[model samples]
Target: MSAFLMENKKLLLDGSVIACVEQRDGEWEDTFICMGENMWLWNRTFTVTDARESWDDFPMEFILQGEVAFYMIPGVNYNGNFWGEGKEPKGLLDDGIPWRFAGHRSGVRAGMLAQTKEAAVGIFAAQENPMGCSMEMERAEKKGFCMRLHFPEQEGPRVYCARDSYEAGKYMETTCFCKKNLVFSAWIVVREPQKQHDYAAFLDKAWEVCREEGSVRLLTDEQVWELGMDFAKNRLYFEEDGFAGFCMGLTWKDKGWEQKRDYLEIGWVGQNASLAVSLLYEYAIFGEKEALRRGLSVLDVWCGRAALPNGLFRCRFDQIRKWGGRIDNDEERNDAANLYSAVTELLEAYHLLAELGIERKLYRKTALAICSFVTQHQLESGKMAKAWFNDGRISDAEGTVGCYLAEALCFGWKECKSREFLNAARAGFSYYYKEFEKYGYTTAGALDTCCVDKESAIPLLRCALELFEITGEREYLEAAKQVSSYLASWQYHYNVQYGGHTLLGQMGYRTRGGTSVSVQHHHIDCYGLEFYEAWKKLAKYTGKEIWRERAEALWENALQNISDGTLVIKGQKRPRGSQDEGILQTRWHTKRGEYFGVSEWLVAWNTAFRLKILRKDFLARKREKSKEEKRIS
Candidate 1:
C-alpha cells in the first residue's frame, strides 16, 4: 500500500488546503478531502457506481493498481487569461438545455481556474451537480481573495431551487457520487502551458490502460437490481407520513427580482389537477383508499366558486393560492382559463378509477363537460389556444395549448366516439402537417423563441403517434418518426460534473443523457422525463428498437434527477428551509434565463407520471409479445 499527500498553502487562501491519498491495489473506493478558508474538508466518494453503458441496477466494481482519477498539475500550466466553465466544453458537454444540473446555466460552470493574476487555483462553484455542498468566493478579502469551501463534519440540509436555498450556502452529502479507490487521481491536466489536452482522448486512454489489467468485470441485471434496492431500503421517503407526503409543495423563501430574500408564504390547501393525478398513483402503488380520498378531495376543491358554472377549474385557487393544471403562474396573462392538460388528466383518471370499482359522479360530469367544450368550440385553424376563459374566449394561446387540445380531442373521440371530437383532431393534424412542411419536425412551442419545446413537443409527438395508432394514417406515422427523431436530437449526451459538486472534479455531473431545449420554461421538470416514454412508443410505432435504445439512455440520465420524499430523509418538517423526503426532483440541468417556476418545489406528480409510463411501456411490450407469439404460433 502507498499513500501520498500534497499541500500548497501558496495555492489558496490562508487555511485553505487540498490533499489526496491513493492506493493502487485495494478496494475500489475513493474520497476527496479539501480544507481551508476557501475550501471545506468535505468527504465525497462516488455514491453511485456500476454503469452498463447507461445507469443500470447492477453496479460493477473493479480492483485496480495504477489507475488515473483526475489531475490539477500546478507546476506546468499554460495560457488562457483564465479558464473555467466554458460556454461549451469540448469533452464533457452541456448545450444549455432545461435538463441541465442546477446553477450550470451561466455556461459550463462549477469549475476552478488557476488564474495567473491571482496565482491561485481558485475553485469556483460549478452548478451542474446536486444541491448538497457549498462554497463562498470572497473576493473582498483584505489580506487576500479567498475562495472558501468549508465542510462541517455535520452540515445542514440540502438547499432547494428557491431564492433562499440559493442564498443559503451549504452542500448535501448525497448530491455527488464517487465510490471508487484511486491510486492516481489529481486535478488539472499536467502539460506544458501551451500544449493541448484532449480530455476525451485521455479518458479513453485511461480506460484502456485499466482494461488491460483484467480488473474489470461485467454485472448481471439481477445484480444491478439487488444493489439498487439495497440502497433504496435505507431511503426515508419510503416510510409513511414521510417528507414527500407533507406540504406536497413545501414552502421556500424566494427572492424575486427584489434584492431582499423573503420566505415564500403559501399554504398548499390541495386542489391541484397534477396532484390529483399523483394521488391516483399513490392508490395504485400502495392500495390505499386514503390516496384516492386525497385525490378526490383535490378535485373537489376545484368545484363550487373556484370553478366556472361549466366546471372548468381555475388556474390558481384564490383561497389556497396554488396555481397548476394547465393554468400555472408561469403564464403572464389569463390566470383563469381551462387547460387541455387539466381536462385530459381528469377524464383519464376518472376512467381509470371507474374501472377500479370507484366512481365519482362529479368527476365524470366535469370530464364529460370539458369534452363537450372542446367539440363546441372547434378552431378553424385546427388548433386551440393554450387557455380559454369561463366565457370560452381564448385568453392565452401562445403556450402550446394546441398540443394538449390535439391529444384531448383524440382521446375524447376514442372515449365518447364523438364525430365532432374526431373532426377537431383531424383539423389539428392538418395544421401540424403545414408546420411539418414548413420546418420539418420542430413545431412551434408555447412561445416563439423555442421552435421545438419539450412541453408542447412531448404532447405533439404523442398526438402524432396516437393519431397513427387510432387512424392508421401513414401521414401521422411518418410525422411521428420525424418528430421522434427531432426530439431525440436534443438529448444531453454527457454529464459535465461526474465527481459531485467539486470544482475541477469529475464525479457528480460530467455524467449526461437528459436535457431538452424549447420555448417552455427553461429549467428541469419531471415532465421532461416523458422524452423517454415518447421514444419508447415511437420505437413501437416505427418498428425500430433504436428509438428504445435512445429512450433508455435518456431515462438512465433522468434517473439521476429522481429523489425520494424529503420528510423522512431529512428527519423533520423541512427544518427552516431545506428539502424533506418524498419530494422527487430529477429534473437536473438548467439553462440560464429560463423561468424555474416552482423548479425546486416537490413534484410527486412526476414520480406518478413515471410510474404510469413504466406500466404503459410494460403493457405495450407485453402486447407486442402477445402479437408476436400469435404470429409465431
Candidate 2:
C-alpha cells in the first residue's frame, strides 16, 4: 500500500496526500488527495476549505487487508423516502456498476466511489451533488457490495443541498459554489494475481488507451476492412424452427425464462427486422444461409403467423399460464405506440427482399395491413391511440408513434404509389410537426409529459430525415439538424475519475447514446442503440463530418462497452467479452441491464446491428478511397 500510494501520488497531475478525516452529526468527510492549479483540464471545479476541526485519521477512508483502499463520502437525498426526515436509504452500490430500484419514494442518493489500490477496478462517480443512485441489486448483500455515501444531515451546509443549481439546457448538476465543491480523482492501485472478474479493470484501462489513440491511428482501408469484418464475424448462431434460422436475437434466457420478440422490444425482432437489409448482403458475400434465413425469419415473425390475425404487430403474447401459449391460442398484445417501428422494419425487409430478387408479396401485404390499421384507427386530429385492443381505450400519444409511422407511410406510398397512404403520412406529419414546432429539440414525443429523449429523439430524427429525402422539404432537414445538434451536447466527452478507476479518452464518451428522464419526475440510463444509424443518415443529409464524426465516435465507444461477463458467468474458457446478440447492456462500464435478460441474454439483433454499422464504415472508407484515387489519377 505504501509504494502504491507513492506511485499514485506521482500520477495525480499535482495530487497531494492529506490524511484528514472527520465526522459531524453523522456526515463523514475524508481529505482525498488535493490538486494543484489549473483543474480545468477535468472540466470540474475544485475547492479546499479549512474545516472546524481535523483528526489524525481520515474518516470513511480505510485500507482493506493492506491491499485495497475504500472511501465513502457523506451524502443526502433531495428526493425519495426520508427526504423530509433528512435521512436516506443505506448507501450501497459502487460507482460505474449499475443497479435497479423501483416504486414510490423508494430512491437511493449517494456520492462517488473510486478504488485505486494496486490495480484500478471498482465503482466510481464524479462530484455532482444531488446525484440519484439507481440500482442496489438483490445480490448486493451476499457480495457485501453496498453504497458508501448517504444523505447529509438536516443541518449541513445549504450549499450541498441546493436544488436551484439545475440549469435549463444542462443535464449535470452545477453549483454556484464551484470553488467550494470538492473534486477528487486518483488512480486505483492494483497488484497482479487477482481473480478473473478483475479483468474488467484491464479492459477498462485498455479501452481508455484505444480512445486516446483512435483519432491518431494510421490504418489503411484494407486494415479498416479487416477490423470491421472481424467484429461482424463474431456472432452467435442458433436454430429456430429448424432452419438454423436466426442469429442470437432478442429472445434470451432470463431468470430461467425466455424473453421473446412478441413485445416489439427494442432489442428483439424490431432490431432484427431493421438489420435484415444488411444481413441479406452479408449472405450474398459469404453464402451464409443463416444471414439470409434470419432475414426471412424477421419477415415471417413481423408479417406471417407470428403477427396478429388482425394484422397488428404483437407487443406481447397474451398468456394463459406459466409457459403456456397466448390465452386465445393467438391473442395479441398490441401496443400501438410502436406501430411506426413495426411498419418501418417491415418496409426495410420488403425493400431488401425485392432487391435480392426475392418476392416481398407477403411482406408488402403485412406492411400495408399495419399502415391501414394506423390510418383507420387514427383520430380526426391525427392522434393514434396508444394501444389496439377490444376495449379501444387510449393509453398515450407520443410523437415517436406519429413520426415513425409517417416515415413508413411515405415508404408505403412510394412502393404502391397510393395517394391514401401518402395523405395518411401527411396527416400524421402535420400533427407531429406541430409538436415539433411547439417544442423543437425539447419534444418528448410522449403525452405523459416526457422530456425530449434519445429513445424517442433518434426515431424522430430518422423520420425527419426520411421525410426530407422523400419531399425535399427544408423543414424536415431542419428538424434533423436541430435534434442532431441537441443530442451532440448530450455526449459525455469529458473525464471522470473515482476510487482508482478513470474514464478518459474515447472510453469516456458516448456519441450514440443519451440518458432519458421525465425531468423532475425521474432519471434513468437509456441506450440509444438506434442513434448510430440515424446520425449516419443525418451526416449524409447535411454533408457534414460532425454528424459522421459522431457516428464514428459512437462506434468506437460501442467497442469500449462490451460486457465483462467473465466476472459473473462461469465455465467459459474466458469472459464472453462481446456477443452477437442475446442480452443488451445499456451502459458501457457494466455488463448488466437495468433489469431482466440483458443481465444474461445477448440478442442477435444487437450484434447484427453492430456488425452492420461496422460494415457501413468499411464501405464508407472504400468509397472515399475510390474517389480519392480518381482525383489523384
Best by lDDT: 2
User: Where is the poorest 10-residue window by lDDT in model 2?
Assistant: 153-162
How accurate locally is residue 540 in candidate 1, as Cα lDDT from 0 to 100? 79
Candidate 1 Cα errors over 4 Å, as ranges? 1-248, 251-271, 303-307, 319-338, 440-452, 497-507, 519-525, 564-601, 614-633
| Candidate 1 lDDT over residue span 510-601, tens digit each | 22344444322223333446656767777776687667765665555445423322322212222211221111122222222122212334
Residue 173 C-alpha lDDT in model 1: 40
> lDDT by residue for model 2 over 1-633, one digit each (tens)?
222232221222124332111124423333334222111111212333456343211112212222223322211121111111111222232233322221111111122222333332222222222322221221232222232221111111111111122111111222323444443322232333142112223223222322433432233434433433333234333334422223333223433323343333312333445455556656654556876776676556545443555556554322211223342432333554346556666666676567658887776777787777667767787655445542233444544444666666777787788887777777776676565444333333333343333344555576677778877988888767765643543333322222212222223422222222222222222234457778878778778755666566555544533444342332222123343222111121123312111234444444445555555455456568879999999
For model 2, the local distance difference test gives: 0.41
Reference-based TM-score, model 1: 0.50
**Deviation of model 2 at 88, angstroms:** 15
List, in order, the clash count of every candidate structure.
73, 41
Q: Candidate 2, which segments miss by more than 4 Å at Cα?
A: 1-272, 275-278, 307-311, 315-331, 336-338, 390-395, 398-401, 436-452, 501-526, 563-601, 612-633
RMSD of every candidate to native, in Å, equals: 17.2, 15.4
